[model samples]
Target chain A: MTIKELANQLNMSTTTVSRVLTGQEKKYRISEKTAQRVKDLAKAHQFAPNQIARNLRLQKTNTIGLIIPDISNPFFANLARTIEVALRKRDKMVLLCDTKDETTIEEESITLLLGRKVDGLLVAPVGEKWAHLEKTNNIPMVLIDRYFEHKEIPYITTDNYAGSYDATSFLISQGHHRIACIQGLVHTSANKNRIKGFQKALADHKVDTAQTFILGNDYSVENGYESAKSLLQAAEVPTAIFALNNQIAIGVMKAINEAGLHIPENISLLSFDEQPYFELLSPPLSSIKQPMEEIGIAAVETLFELLENKKVTSSRLKPTLIPRASVKSIVKS
Target chain B: MTIKELANQLNMSTTTVSRVLTGQEKKYRISEKTAQRVKDLAKAHQFAPNQIARNLRLQKTNTIGLIIPDISNPFFANLARTIEVALRKRDKMVLLCDTKDETTIEEESITLLLGRKVDGLLVAPVGEKWAHLEKTNNIPMVLIDRYFEHKEIPYITTDNYAGSYDATSFLISQGHHRIACIQGLVHTSANKNRIKGFQKALADHKVDTAQTFILGNDYSVENGYESAKSLLQAAEVPTAIFALNNQIAIGVMKAINEAGLHIPENISLLSFDEQPYFELLSPPLSSIKQPMEEIGIAAVETLFELLENKKVTSSRLKPTLIPRASVKSIVKS
Candidate 1:
């Protein structure tokens, strides 16, 4: 039933009925008894306002567009779930656009979301470019997980540098003079910061630069597999391997298994981002767990702040190093 | 720039310019030269049609509402990714509402989507009741993965009964007579049909019903863990455990690990719905792999057919049983 018909049947003005139904009774100074009476009748008639028509009149869709690199990736999937729940609590629905980690798709998704007139956007961009995103006409956007260095857009992300540095230090302390790092998407700030952290940790420990190696250009299992396979077959393999993400770590494990190598004994391994299955894996994988829930909550909070015209600043939360049985100690006392 | 502004600058009618811009040049019999001229100027000026205004005018939003029980679950996450890609190719964006496996949220999401006037809906219903969905006023919708048996809504899902039956038969063949089936959401058709298959397989094999058991009422790791823990501490533990879904299987594994029991040696384990990490598990779990990609593609096709007023029927695709190290050959001469 339409709200107008319900208002007529209740013997009340349409504005008074709308104010009561929309929870604006206090703002409009409507009497509590009158508001309750209108609500009771509206409920009895099962009346619902036409949100699309109302949204058009108000020029606000009350929807947020979420653009992520890969929805199938457990890290992003978990993050997306958290973000969705967080936004849903505030009565905002999400339009999910998975970019498949491609720059062109990311650009297209941004245009599509903007064209839908979403109240805000939360993006985990694929590439280093943000030119297409820059012309959003101030639609209250917030970058999540991935962002550009010089971009003015606010973002919430994990402290990748600290996470990586600690991970490298953990491996180094195990007496691993030679370590190989598998990186993802070379130009991304997350990847760059992780690489910096890995290198700095090695440098701080006075490890030889020539002994460490960095490889791969994409955040994928295949990239990790190929890099690990090549390294395993080399004349001298690194004593340990550090994967920048969980997908890469899975690939590294597959390669290790195929080569008849076991974790810790044959080669120690470490990965960024803890997965639910990590603990269930053989010997359990040692990982730097990203604070996905925190990131999700903070991103929504930042976006809502922007929607409210409040000044929002980018923030990064620390990641924790979860040491499992995957890493081996090579020191001989 | 607006279409009118672009039309005036090109010295052409707004309708002609719009027809070309919206990829309707062939339908409107607009010349190729005129289409090229219109596109060239539109691209140079970076002009985009306001989709919201245009959608309102046509009463078609080109958006589909997708309501799934869980997005963090790999099965649903992978399915969502595939559906999004398939629909995006048809120029449709998905408005995702993750129900978190709640019936109330499912109802609320349906109302929200209908309020926005989405072109179609694809839902993985959380519960058996579909009374709220019955009054959609002729909006196109296709249930995916989960649905009610008595509901008129069309759906595309995996053959759950066949998958469960085959898994049970495989276990029986391996000399596992005492088996326990851990179920998920007792009221769901998917779980009910799977239970039927498990019982039928045991009956065919002449395994005593009292020896075999069905436990758990939710699709969660905690349920699996609790059920397995109780069974493990019981007077007679089952020779093997059948987990209804991947989440339950993970929980079962956790309980087994905590009890210091090994897979296939102390007790065998089998799970419905294959996961990427299943093969990477300690003993590499044996599982029935659902055709998630096929189901996603079919659901979209069915929704689009409904959108075009074409006759559609609910169809079930077959699942494959993958045997790995978790299930051992206990057959004795």
Candidate 2:
């Protein structure tokens, strides 16, 4: 029912009814009994004030916008879950915009979220450079899982380089001299750090870095499969392979299986991130596990901090190495 | 900047500015050049007209709400990706709400989506009963990948019973005397249908119904692993195990590996739904492949139809089995 009808039913002026519905009548010293009566009647009638009227009166949507590259990825999905739980604790809600890892879509999502007048934003940018995001900097934002070129923005992410270096060095300690690396998208800082970590491991061992192998592609199981096939077919296959992410690692395992090779027997496999199915794999996978929960918690915490203190903060949490059967000790020449 | 300020700057009336901004001036015989000038000025000023205003004016959000149990599941993720792509092609956007398998959270998401006045909803309900969802008959909804008690609501789902029956029969065709089944959440129609199909297969083959095995749990890889372990340790282990979903099958495979048993050697396995990593397994997993893309496309299509026709329609698609190395013939028995 319309506000006028409710007002007429309550024998109150339309102005008073509007004020009561908008919760402003109390501020104007309307009697508590009258206000309660209006609220009870409105509830009984299942009256919902038009959103436009409510929004216009409150000047706030009470919603936060979340833009992520891919919601289907376990990492991002976990992050989103954590963020949602955290926000729920604070009585706030999220408006999610999945960009599907496309730059144009990312831009469009940002604009749309801004147009919605969300109180704040949490974004995991798809690319390093986002001019649209930079141009529309009016809203508060916290970048999660990935960073942007604009260092002024607050961001929370794992130490990709350290994680990769530790993983690579662990493989080396296991006597895996010849190693292959499957990289994520080359345009991002995360992929670059991983490459640096892999190279550093080879340099520390005084191994001819040229002999060490690297393949760059998007983070997907299909890409992992293709890269693993090419690496295994090389003239001299590496003793161990490091897949940058779990999806790729799964793909690599498939390639190895297709080639009639077994993990750590014919070759070793290691990857970044832990998949729930890892322990279920024939030979449990060895990898560096990023602190997904911590990353999400920290990102939300940072977002709130920025919202409250209006300050920019950046953090990179350390990654932990999870050793499993996938890595095998190589025979030294 | 407000419309008043824009009008002052452009030497026009506030009504004209509002009209041009809302795209109503043209219908009122306002010149095209003036409207263009107003738009260009607004663009230059970077004025974002409040979304609520535009939404109220247009009576549409151009946004569809998508609620799923979990985004990390490859099946749901793939489905979400398809929906996103399909919606994008139609120049529409999706607002994703991940319930993380919590029924309360799912209900809360629906309320929030409704509060936002989304044009329509595409939901994969957590389980069989959703009284809260039923209470809201105002919103047009299309259930995707899940079913509900409310028959009136439109839904798009796979033929779970037929798929399961075909998978179980295939194992019987391989001369499997004893077959086991790993089921999903029993509260879901999908899981119930699969179980019915399994039972039907055993009855058709004249196998002792009491000897037929069934394990029920969430459709996750961990459940698969645990169920496989228990099934293997049983007094009479089945020659073949039919996992109701891919995650469980993956877990079962891992359990087999850990037990130092080879697939199709000590035991054969077949599962419902195809996972990308299935082919990567040592012995490629045999699976019933759901028409995932079709389900996704159909979900959006159904949502649009509901919005346009204001009528509900339920549709179901069939799944096909993809034969792989996981299943082997029982030669002696």
Candidate 3:
């Protein structure tokens, strides 16, 4: 039923009914008992608020577009789920689009979301390009996971540099000198920061860069397999391998087993973003976990602030390590 | 730019430009050369075809709501990504809403999607309730994975009955007399068919129900762990356990490892729906792999057919067995 109809039937003003329906009764000073009665009657009649008309009136779409690179990867999937859930609580729905890690697809999705006139956008972009995204029609937008700090877009992401550095140092402390590193696109800030973290960890320990191998073509399983295959064929293989993400890490494990090596025994392994299945892996896995829940909450908060014309800055949260049995110690026993 | 402006700039009819932009030129006998020219110009200008305006004119949203039960589960994630990719190819966008396996959430999402004037819906509903879904404002809808035949809704799901039957029979042939069957919502069609298959396989082999244990409260990791824990605590634990899904299977693995039991030796395990990480597990799980790709494609196909007012029937595709090393042969070994 329409709010006006409900208001007339309840012998109450339309403003009072609207306030109660939108859960703004506290501001309107409506009694809790009256609010409860209104809600019970509305539920009985299966009343669903017309968000579309209301959106048009407020010059808002009441819809947010969530663009991710890939949903097959649990990291993106989990993040998307969390964001959608959080948005729902704010009485907003999500339009989901995946770029499949292609910059062109991401651009097209942005255009589509804009044409649909979304009130806001939350994106984990595929690349560093931002000149094109500058025209957001003043709609509130927040970046997630990946971002371009050179641009004014507000973002919430895990500290990739710190996460990768800590993961590398942990392996080195376990007496692993020669380690293999997997990388995504070399130009993206996340990749640059991750590589920096890996290299900085080795530099801090006074290790030579020539001792490590930076491998991979993308953040995918196929890249991991190919990289590990040729690396294992080398006469001097590394003692530990640090994968950038869960998808690639799974691929690395397969390649290791195919080469007849045991985890943390012949070859120690590590990855970022802990997944549920990671724990059930052969030796479990030592990996860095991103603060996804906090990031999801922060992204929404930034978008709401932007909606109010408030300035928002890019923010990064710390990543924690959940060490399992994937790393082995070889400290001169 | 607007279609009219683009048409005027190209010295072509607005209808022709619309047809070319919407990939419908060939239907109107428009020349391929002209269509190509139009497409190239559209790409050059980064034209988005104004889906919102078109939706308003046609009294259609030109958007489909995809309501999935869960996305953390790879099965649904893959299916969703595939569906989204396929839908985008047709110039349609997706509104994603996850019920998180909650009936109330599913109902709320459905109502919200309807109120948003969505032209169609693709839902993998939770629970067996259908009366609430019949009032979708006459919007064309298709079911995915989950189905309700009594509601006259079109659906695409894997052949759970045959898949479960084959798995149970294979375990029986391996000399497994005692098997544990984990189910998700026993009253649901999928669980009912799966349980039916298991019972039929046992009856055919003359194995008594007394030799089996039917457990599990839901299709979750926690349920699987608890069910497996209590089952392992029994004086006579089953020789094999057939988990309902991938998440449950992972939990079963954890419970087995916690109880100091080795896979395929102390207890054989099988599950439905193969995930990428399943192979990386300690023993590499054996699973009944559903035709997720085919189901996703079929789901889109059915939705399009419904959009065209074509009568579509619920269809089922076969599941394949990926026999990894998780199942053991106990026959006279």
Candidate 4:
């Protein structure tokens, strides 16, 4: 039954009936017995207290908004899962807004989130454009996995530059000079930092930058496979390859196998991020494993810090290197 | 500023002020000049119409609910992503309730969904006991992946029995007399059908049912690894193994590798569900692959069907087997 019908049945005004049902009549001098009766009838009828009505009375929605680039990606999916778990622990629900990497969709999602009146926001902004987001609302926001163009906002991300440099240097130390690199989207901060790291490794080893080879493309297994195929087909293929991500590495391995080449024998391989089945493959793959769980936990911690104290906070966690059999030393010709 | 302040500033009634702000008064005798003034004042003050208030007036939340066993699993994660994408296309939103494989949580999540007045529900029940869900609400619901104890409701799933039978028979044709099966949780209809199919294959081949072995566990990579470890340590290991899912198959391979046994030489392996990275491994994995995208699209279609007609419908899609390098013919001693 609707609130008006319930109010007529209880011989009370509609406003009084709504206030009682939403548990806001404690200060209204409504008798305890009357309030309890209204509650019992509402429960028996399976009546849902209108959230909008409750919000009108309380001036708060008690909901948080989350906007992420992609949910199909395992890393983002896991991050979303952890954030949901953490928020639930605090008795807050989340409204998830997936942008799918489209700027127009991202802006629309932000507007919708604002319209919903979420108490705060947890965003992983797409691309380098932050002006639209910065001007949207004064809602409390904590960015994760990527930084904002404006440094005023708090964000948490892994050290991509150092991680890439260390991964490349490890391969060089294994006596590999002719190395090929598979990179992600060029303009993204994460991809740019990774390229910088790869270059720094070559410079530190006194290897000519011109001798180092790089291929930039989208972050997909198919792209990785295509790039690796061309690299392997080169007149003088590199002795080792550094694939920027797990999916790319997997693709590269597929292309290599299709061409009758083997890992660490015909060509060595290294990648960022580790998958569950990485060790099961022939010649276990070595990788720069990002601290996923740690990052998830840390993002929540930063969000909570912002929630508790109305201040900005930022953090960047270091990545760890995992050595396996994917890389082999280059033998002199 | 409140609507009352805007009305006072414009020297109009609060109802007129709200009508202009909502664009409803033009047809109700309000002048365009007055409406523009109201709109300008509202915009200058960054005034947001209370959605909670509007929802209270309309008595609808405009949200859908999704209940899944585990969001962390890749299969379920992909399903959630598909549902989210579909909902976004229609300008509808979703509230995800992750059950984490607990029946109590499943029941609680349903209650929470009902409390929120979700327009419809998409659920993948955790176990055999789903009476609580059946009793919770009469809302439109479309079951996915798993079926209920009673078959009155609608669902969408892959043909597990047919896929399993074909995979097992293929192994038998390869001259394997002793075949071991690793099964998922027994409570699920998918697991039960898979086991039935595996046994049927052996019976059709005139093999002694008592000679074939079965190991039941959850469909997890770690469990697959542990089961494989135990099977390998046995006095006489099976010449062929069929893992019910990809995660278990991956674990089985790791266990075999750790035991210093070679695939196709020591033991041949086959599994259900294909992962993209599976072919990139040392020896490409052979699997019965489900049409994931089809299942996702079908789930949405089924949900809409239930929403429109309130009629129960169940659809099953067939699976295809992909032959790779993991399986080998058995040689008799």
- Cα lDDT of model 2 by residue, A56-113, tens digit: 5687776788887776677777777788778877767777777877788888888777
The C-alpha stretches of model 2 lying farther than 4 A from their native spots are A1-5, A13-32, A47-52, A260-262, A310-312, B18-26, B221-233, B250-264, B310-312, B331-333
TM-score of each: 0.93, 0.91, 0.88, 0.89
Query: How much of the true A–B contact set does each candidate keep?
Result: 0.69, 0.40, 0.68, 0.45
Summed backbone clashes in each candidate are 0, 1, 0, 1
**Which pairs, if any, clash in model 4?**
A52-B52
What is the lDDT, from 0 to 100, of the residue B320 in candidate 4? 91
| Candidate 4 lDDT over residue span A234-294, tens digit each | 8889888999888788889988988999898989999887777888777889988887777
Expressed as tens digits, the lDDT of each residue in B200-291 for candidate 4 is 99999987766678995788888889999999988888988899988789889989998999887889999888888778665878899988
TM-score (chain A only) for the predictions, listed in order? 0.92, 0.92, 0.85, 0.88
- In model 2 chain B, the worst 10-residue window by lDDT is B128-137
**Ranking under lDDT, best-scoring first?**
1, 3, 2, 4
CA shift of A109, model 1, Å: 0.5
In terms of lDDT, model 1 sits at: 0.92
Clashing pairs in 1: none
- DockQ ranking of the models: 1, 3, 4, 2
Off by over 4 Å in 4: A1-52, A310-312, A331-333, B1-50, B310-312, B331-333
Model 1, residue B155: C-alpha shift (Å)? 0.9
Residue pairs in clash, model 3: none
